[model samples]
Target: MDDERLRPTQLPLNDLATAYVQAGQTLFLAILDDIAARVRLAHPEAAYLEIGIDADGDVELHGIWSAQESAIGTCRLLYDPHDDPEQEWRDGPLDLDELVDDLGRVLTGSFLHHWGVVEPHPVYEHRDRRWLVLPPADRAATVAAIVRGHVPDAESLICRFAERGERIAVGFEQVTLSGGGTISVPCPLCSPETEDGPWPRDVSHELARILGQLYALPHLRGRHLTPCVDITAEHEGQLWQLVFPYRDHKKGAESS
Candidate 1:
C-alpha cells in the first residue's frame, strides 16, 4: 500500500551486467585472435577470417577460406573436433586446411585441449588417424627444433625432401633423454626395416626443419604450456613414430 514499497529498488544490476559482458568480450577476442594468428601463419593467403564466441559460449568462425593452385576448394567446413561422421557442417565456412593447421597437429591439439577450456578429456587422437614414431634421441632434437624455430643442420635437406615428396619416418627405439627431455626434426625417406635405427645426418636435419615449422606456429609458440609429445608422422603411405616433450616438460614447468 505504501508508495515506497511499490517502487523497485535501485540496484546496480546494469553496471554488473556491463562488467560481465566486457570481461566475456575480452576473453572471446583474445581466443579468436590467437586462433586467427595461427591460421594465417599456416595459410599466408587466408583472408577475412572472423572468430567469436556467442553469449551461450558457442565459438564460431566466418569469412575464412583457402586457395589451392591446382585443386578445387570447398565452400564450407565441418568444425567438429572429434571428426564425427554424423556431425553437421558449421554455418560458417573456413579454410579447412588452415583450420587443420591450427587445430589438427598433435602439438596444436594439446595446446587447445589444455587451454581452450571447452571440453573435458580432449580428443587428440581424432587427428591422429596417421602419425610417426621416432627414437628418443630424435624426439629430443625435434622438441628443441620446435621451440627454436629452425632445424639445426638440415634446412636444405628438408627443402629437398619436400620437393621430392619425401617425409621423415618415426622409429620405436626405447631411449630416453636425461630428465625425460625429447626433441624433434622433419624426416627423410623412411624404411620399415630400419625404423629402430638412428636417422641419417640428412634425415635428422630435415626432421628438424619440419618441426621448426610447427614450433613457429603462434598458438604453439605463444602458449605458456610447454608441450611434450610422442612423435609420429605420416608420409607417402609410410607410418613411423617420434618423441615429444611430455613428462619432462610438465616437471620443468612445475619446478619453475
Candidate 2:
C-alpha cells in the first residue's frame, strides 16, 4: 500500500489551534502553537509547507519548506521503549490526560534522535529539536498534569504558586466543574487593565503548549485542570485562591 494513501493529512498548526480554541479545550494557546512548530522540526524530511496566521490574523508562515528533506533519506527517527509514540496525536482530539501522557513521551524521544545521529546530517542541522527531548505529544501531557493538578479518588490538586504575571482575567468568580469538582483559579490577565483580553501570542515551550491546548479542550469546560500559581505578593495582595477539583470548593468562587 502506498504510504501516501494511508498517510494522514497534517493540519496546519495555527488552524488546528484555532479549531481547538473554538471548541474550548485549548488550555494554553501559546504552548499549543509551539508544539506545532516542534512537529514541523521533527519531520523536516517531509517536503510540506506550512502557513501560520499572525495576531492581526494575517498569514505568517505560508510557503515555508522544511529544512530536513535532503538528509531525511539517511536520517531516521529514533525509537525507544521508554519513548512514547507521538504518531498517535497527529489529528488530535486530545484531552488533558492524553496530552500529558504524550508530552512525557516526546521528552524522552529527544534522546532517541540524538543517539541515532551517527553521520551528521545537514538537512535538519538548524531544525528545532526541542521536542527531541520529549516528543511534542508527550511534552503537552506532562505539563498539563503539572499545572492542571489531578484527581485521585476524593482528593484534588490546584496550583498555588506560578511564574505568571500578565495574561487574561475572565473576571474574579469561583466556578464549578462538571463533576462537582470545584476550583477557584484567578485569571488575573483577563481584566482589561491587565491584558488585552485575547492575550498576544508567544513561542512558549512545546510541552507547555500541549498543556495549553489541553486547557483549551472543549471537554475541559469549567474544568480548572491547570493550577495557577497563587500571587501572594505583599504588594499584589494575597491571592488565596487555589481550589481542588473536588466537591469541597468551587472554582473562582471564594472558598467558604
Candidate 3:
C-alpha cells in the first residue's frame, strides 16, 4: 500500500467529532426550518433545535414552536377505540379511577416512541396490563383538562380527548390552527419536504409521527407506529435546552 493510502480514517469523538455533531445539528435544523415554513411562516429570532445522532446512531429531535416559548413540546392523545373496556364498564362501575391509573401507565410505556429503521412495533400492553376505558363523552374533556393541569409544563406534551376520530398519532401540532388539510396547514406528509430518509429527515419523520398521535385522540384506534424526534442543546452544567420537533418546529439556525 502507498504510504498515504494506509492512513487511518478519522473517527468522531473530540474536535472532529464535536464538529461533526455541530454540522449534523445544523443540517437537522435546516430541514426543520424548511418544514416549519409550512406551519407558521418564519421568525428572524427563532430556530428549531436538532439533537444530533447518538454514538449508537440513534437520533432524538426537538423544536421550539413560538416566539415566546423556547421549547418545542410533544403531546400524545390516546383513547381506546375498542369499546371492550367501556362495554365492560356498561355492565357496572368497577375501580374506574384505578383503571385510569392503569391506562396512564400503559400509555407511558408507549414512551419508547421510535425504534428506528426497524419495524415500529411499540409494546402497547405488558403482562396483565391493558388500557383502561375513559369516562363518558361528557366527562372526557374534564378528565383531559385535569390531566393536563397536573402534568409538568416543561414536557410541552399534552394528551387529551378532543377529536372524534379513531387514530392515535403523534404530530408536530400547531396550537393555533383552527382547520385541517394539506393546504390549510402543513402537516408532515402534507409538506413538500416529506420524502424517504436516514438523513436528519429522520428527525422530521419522528416529529410528524408523534404529532399525528396527538392530533387524533380520545377515539384512538388499534394500530400505531410511534414516531419520535430527539434534539438537545447543552448549556452550563449538564443542563441543555431540549426540543422535540415532533411538534414540527424548527427553532431557526443561530445567525452567524
Candidate 3 accuracy as lDDT: 0.29
lDDT values, one for every candidate:
0.36, 0.34, 0.29
lDDT per residue, candidate 1, 76-182, as tens digits? 32123435645434423445555544433322323232222223211264332221111122323455454334322221111111111122222222223444444
> What is the TM-score of each predicted model, taking all chains together?
0.22, 0.23, 0.19
Q: Give the C-alpha miss distance for residue 228 in model 3, angstroms.
A: 28
> After superposition, which runs of candidate 1 have C-alpha atoms over 4 Å from their true positions?
1-10, 48-64, 67-256
Worst ten in a row by lDDT for model 3: 234-243
- Which is the leading candidate under TM-score? 2
How many steric clashes between backbone atoms does each model show? Answer: 38, 51, 34
The TM-score, computed over Cα atoms with residue i paired to residue i, of candidate 3 is 0.19
- How do the residues 1-256 of candidate 3 rate in per-residue lDDT, one tens digit apiece? 6765533644433457655533443333333323334322222322222222345443322222223243565323212223375455422323334433332332332221221211221234422222121112222233223323332122233212122122223333322111321111134445656543222445544444433332333122212213233322211111111122222124323432
Q: What TM-score, to 2 decimals, does candidate 1 have?
A: 0.22
Output the TM-score of candidate 2.
0.23
The lDDT-based order of candidates, best leading, equals 1, 2, 3
Candidate 2 per-residue lDDT, tens place, 155-176, comes to 3323222222221112232333
User: How much is 166 displaced in model 2, in angstroms?
Assistant: 10
